[model samples]
Target: MTRATVQRWAAFSDDPGGGNPAGVVLGADDLDETGMQRIAADVGYAETAFVMGSGRERGIRYFSPVAEVPFCGHATVASAIALAGELGDGPFAFDTPVGRVDIETRTDAGVRTAAFTSVEPWIEELPDATLGALLALIGLGPGDLDPRHPPRLAFAGNRHPLLVLADLGAFDSLTFDPGEARTLMDAEGWPATIIVLHEHGAGRWEARNIFPVGVIAEDPATGAAAAATGGYLRAIGAVTPPARVLIEQGRHVGRPGLLTVDIPESGGITVSGTAVPIG
Candidate 1:
């Protein structure tokens, strides 16, 4: 097996304790599936990013401990920051399974900001029964949901199910049984769930995720879900035509994050965020 070089960074916040941590392995053109999975599990972050190709542009892939997802926002950010630390700043091409993405890094001193766009987007309809079951697993109900936004599954390079709560009351009072959440989500074809309480009039929102974790529970911040939420908001008319929404997440988990997403009137969504070295 070709042992790859790895680095770690936490995206969306400066403080190591204030953002989602992700693994980055540059020039990962030789590692196979088992090696990737082993590295991911050992790092034990929600996801890890591997970059291949070189020159001014390259390819990237994201792997969770258990699976390799098409795209991962935070990890993408983390990977860019990693590249910037060694290669200096500019725009680079990230060839992901989902599509070829562009990342522009703006570096000041040692801090790096990785900004990238998702391939396109799509939305999924959530049924009433699924809603009931999900809420039950999370220990929330329809009453806790935001009347204006409703529930939906959204996508920007990957799939995400967004759950909106009525107010800060519902947002601050979040609780869930991780084991049950895993079982439910496993059946739902969703990788993560984003529970949000909107505050940007209609377009801005604050959210957090509670992943099944397979054996455990929790995910500090989820990029795929954030992208999906933006898409859903646009589709459901919650966002105005000029919809450029910001999603704040991971604060509760100490990894405070901000995801800026632009939802177009017609096709795919663009999600952007920053990443800094936690190494």
Candidate 2:
């Protein structure tokens, strides 16, 4: 069996210590599912991206330390930047498990950024019982919820429960049971993370992604969650169409990251961020 080389990247931030770290394997056409999972686990990142082809169109798979996910935005961004370094910056089409994703890569001011258009997004109301359970799991009460934005299950590529808090202090003091949260997420088929948001201004939000991927209790940055947030805001009429939203995340974890989301009147949401090689 051939061993595939893995590249490490920090997504959503230019600094190596900032954004979420991801493992990218280029030319992984020979690797099997077990091999990919082993590599992901060994890399110890939230997710790892495996590319099966080396053309304008490619087959991509995302795997966490424990299991394979339908899609992973941070890994995709990391993989795109890695590919751009070798193949030159341009557009690449990915055939993910959820559906087709088109990612565009560009260089501005000597910084490379990749933007991926998510699959058609939608939102569903979170059940009353589920909402209560979620609140309890996070040590947050019903009163802490923002009245303006109701709890809902948002989906871009993966499902995430969107819970908007009324105060930023809640985020500063946020905590959750990783074991319980993982069980709930697995049972609910939410392969990504639980997104907690606090709107600081119009089209701007501070987000915390609760992701228990192996030993990692939280995700410093989650592009999928950011995309889902955009869809949730649009579906709930919280934001107008043709809007650009900013998501600030990873601060609580000490790895500050930023995500730019572009919401059109319809169709997929575009999530953009820059990734830098991690030393």
Candidate 3:
């Protein structure tokens, strides 16, 4: 069996211990699904990115410990930075299961950063019954929702139900049964339940992603969800066009990370972050 080289990286934060950790496998052409799963499990990160092919024509696959996901934002960022370190900084295109994604990497003031433009995103209203069930399962009521941002199912590369909470207190006190949440997510074909708290300042938000589908209780920094949220806000006219938003996540879980989202009037959303090697 040909061995695959796996490197650990923390995405969305320059500090290795403060961001979401991901495993990046370069030269992964020799690995199959089973091999990737095993490697990801051993790495014990939320997600692992396997890169095949070369240059801008890369084929990328994302695997959690248990299963393969169509796309992963933080892992993608980590993969890009890893590639940049070895192949030099420039634009790269990855063919993901969902669609083609374009990423660019560069270094500024000694910090390497990567920005990815997600596939076209859309929003749909969550069914009342499903929304009710989700709230009940999470021990939250409709009243806890932020009046400005209504509940909606947002999709970029994957689907997640976006719930904007009323205050930091509600967001901080969120708790749910992982088993039940996983069951619900799998049955509904949803990857995460994104709970967000909008801060007083413009373009500032705090988010938590409950990712039971990946067998992860929570994701510190989620690129896909952040992109989806930016699209959702644009669709709902909650934010003006050509806006840039900063998302703070994973702090509550002790892995603080930052995600910057740029939303245009139309088309793909851009999510940017820094990834550093976890030595």
Q: What is each predicted model's overall lDDT from 0 to 1?
A: 0.75, 0.93, 0.88
Between candidates 2 and 3, the one scoring higher on lDDT is 2
**What is the Å distance of residue 5 in model 3 from its true position?**
1.3
By lDDT: ranked, best first: 2, 3, 1
Instruction: Return the TM-score for candidate 3, rounded to 2 decimals.
Output: 0.97
Q: Where in model 3 is the C-alpha error above 4 Å?
A: 192-195, 213-215
Candidate 3 local Cα displacement, residue 255, angstroms: 0.3
Candidate 3 differs from the real structure by a C-alpha RMSD in angstroms, to one decimal, of: 1.3
Which has the greatest lDDT?
A: 2
For residue 172, model 3's alpha carbon misses the true position, in angstroms, by 0.8
* CA lDDT, candidate 1, residue 218: 61
lDDT of 3 by residue, 133-205 (tens): 7787768899988888899999989998888888778778888888887888888887544545556467789
Which of candidates 1 and 3 is the stronger one according to lDDT? 3
Model 1 has how many clashing residue pairs? 4
Q: Candidate 1 has which clashing residue pairs, if any? A: 18-255, 19-255, 120-268, 121-268
> What TM-score, computed on C-alpha atoms, does each candidate reach?
0.90, 0.98, 0.97
Query: What's the C-alpha lDDT at position 6 in model 1?
Result: 75
lDDT for position 278 in model 2? 90
